[model samples]
Target: MRAVVIESPKQLHVTTLPDPTPGPGDVVVRVAGVGLCGTDVHMLAGEFGPTVYPVVPGHEFSGEIVAVGSEVQGYAEGDRVAADPAVYCGSCHFCAIGRGNLCEKWGTIGITMDGACAEYVKVPAANLYRLPQGVDLGHAPLIEPLSTIVHGLDVVAPSVGDHFLIYGAGTMGLLYLQTARRNGAASVSVVDLNADRLAVAEQLGADHVATSADELDRVTTGWEVVVDCTGAVPAIEDAFTRVRRGGTFQQFGCAPDQEQARFSPFRIYNDEIRIVGSMAILHSYGRALDLLAKGWIDSDTMITHRFGLDEYQKALDTFSQGTGRKIQIVPSLAPGA
Candidate 1:
């Protein structure tokens, strides 16, 4: 098997490696398509603190099962599936309280273990969610990221008819826009530095799009739900001020661990504003898959670039340049290969 290995910060190598074998409770998936998220970028740059080096860095992925563990049931070879990368210590205090996302020993597939930027990768059978009848593996990688966004919404728990103001029209931001509208936001507005992204947001059902929140009309007091998906310090700070009184503000993006943003504690208290942080996918992967199968999301338009596994570096480069929506790695399918 061949895979991409991050030797260290700024060091990457793609070469042949031994095929993975399923343990007693694991299954080995034949890699189909893998999506790269901002977390992968941070891992590659050594910015993600918990990432263990010499690890394969890909978490948002979709594939088919080729081998199942002896204890595995319900899933079999040839089953198209998307694996949830989140793995938590089941005995932690947070896990005991039904908050596995906050487990003390929280770890993810690509970040903490070898992942699917290869021809084959091992996954826990329990984490596998077989795709519904109509969903294809190509677009199914969106499930992982969408699930996280779903959890973000769960954190906000916004009521129907509430206005939503989202910062960042990147892949995650656009997904937030789609889901927010579906969740009954009266209107969804998007802000991004890129004009192209803002345009796509509008085409994807955003009521308004702009390079800055100040450019948006109406809702002058603020929005009922304000989400920051860019994770930039400035954007996070700006999003804080855009939340309407008694509204919720969700920090959904991954910012540098050392970075900090300013916000008004007085305003939060006086206006009854709620500030929450949504981590990665919780129990939302299955829901995300079901939503996609139900045609709730436009997956086709969400994924904009695909490359072969050998071109992992190229995928990273394109991602860094911020040229595409959801850039992915298809182990066997490179358009111009």
Candidate 2:
């Protein structure tokens, strides 16, 4: 099988390797589409912690099951599915409390283990969720990230009349806007440095879009929910201060580990502000699938580019340049290519 191999930090190769076989509790999926995000870039740069080099780095993927583990039930060949790449230690204290995302030994498929960047990848059967009959396998990759946002919403716990101010209008931010619109946000405002993304944000239902909060003068009373969807330190700091008194702020972006920002501790105490952090997918995977199946997300707008296995690096370039939205890798190239 030809796969994108991150042999080391700042190094990548598309090489042929032995195709994967299912473990007793796993299934082998013939890869269809895998979405590229900042996490994949960080993994390639060796910046994201727990990224083991010589690994395949695609976590957001959907495909068809070609082989099922002996112990697996209710799944078989020809089943279409999107997988939750998260793999957790079930005995950790966090897992005991239904917080597997916070498990002490938390790991993910593409990050810590081999992943679905190849023609065929093995996945745990427990992680597989069958795609609905009409859902595009190409767009199903969005479900993984959508699930993360769902968990973020769970953390912030938006109310019916809450106004949302989201920083970053990239794929994640626009998805946030759409979800907020559907979930009863009175208004959704977005901030981004990119005009392209901002325009898309408006198309996706962002009531107010700006390059910065200072440009959004009409939001004088502040927002009930302020979310930092951009992992940049400056954006995070600015968004954090925009939360209204008694409102909630969520850190939904994955910032560089060493980056730091200072928040006004006194304001948090005096104004009763709530700060919440969301990591990865939790129990929200199935809900995300439901939302996708229900046609809640505009798949056509979210995905902007597609590439075959040979064009993986080109896809990376397009993603890093911020010239496109979600870029996908279609790995099922001609056999032995």
Candidate 3:
């Protein structure tokens, strides 16, 4: 089987590898589509802490099950599914307390193990969520990322009429916009440096879009819910100031490990503001899949580009350039296939 291997920091290649076979409790998925995001970018550059060299880097994906482990039950070959990439130790303190997202030994599929950026990849059977036969496989990859958005909302626990101001109009931001609308937000405002991304935010039900929060016409107190989806220091700093008194601020993006942002501690105390950080998927994958099946998200508009396994580098380049929404790699095809 052909796979993309990150041999070391600043090095990557699409090369052939032995086909993966399922373990007693795992299943082998014939890769259909895998989405690329900032985490993959960081992993490629050796910036993600959990990632090791000579690994395949792709986690947001979905495909058909070609082989099932001997112990797998209630699933069989030809079943279309998406697997949660999050791997955690069941005995960790966080996991014991139902916070597996912060498990002491937390790891993810692409970041910590060989992932679905190949013709076939192995996944724990318990992590697989079946997709409806009617759904398009190309768009199924969005479910994994969307699940993170779901978890973010769960962390915020915002009121139905709360106004939202989200930083970044990238894929995660756009998903946040759509989900906020569905969650009964009084208004959803999106901010991004990219005008094209703002336009897409508008198309996806954002009540307002702008390059900066200063350009938005909101109350002097600011939005009831503020979210940072850029993982950018500047964006996170700006987003922190947009939360209204007694409102909530969510760090939903994967910021660089070494960066820091400034916030008014006095204001947080006086205004009763709550600041929370949402990690990766946490028991939300199934809910996200159900939402996708219910048409809560516009998957068609969310995905903007496609590449094959052989074009993984090109896909990563486009991602680094910040040129598209959800870019995907279909491991079974060539560049334009």
lDDT of all predictions: 0.90, 0.89, 0.90
Q: 1-337 in candidate 1: lDDT tens per residue?
A: 9899998988999989999999989999998899989998888888889888889888988888999999998999999989899999999899999999988998889988999999999999989988887998898999999999899988888898999999998899999999888998899999999999989999999999888888888548889899999889999998899998998999899998878888899998999999899999888999998888888789889989999988888898998898989999998975466
Badly placed stretches (over 4 Å) of model 1 are none
lDDT of 2 by residue, 104-180 (tens): 99889888898888998899999999988989998899999999988888888888989899999888988888888
Reference-based TM-score of each model: 0.97, 0.96, 0.97
Window of ten residues with lowest summed lDDT in model 2 = 328-337
Worst lDDT window (10 residues) for model 1?
328-337
Error of 2 at 187 (Å): 0.5
lDDT of 2 at 258: 67
Angstrom error at residue 336, model 1:
3.8
Cα RMSD to native, each candidate?
1.2, 1.9, 1.1
Instruction: Choose 2 or 3, whichever is better by lDDT.
Output: 3
RMSD of 1: 1.2
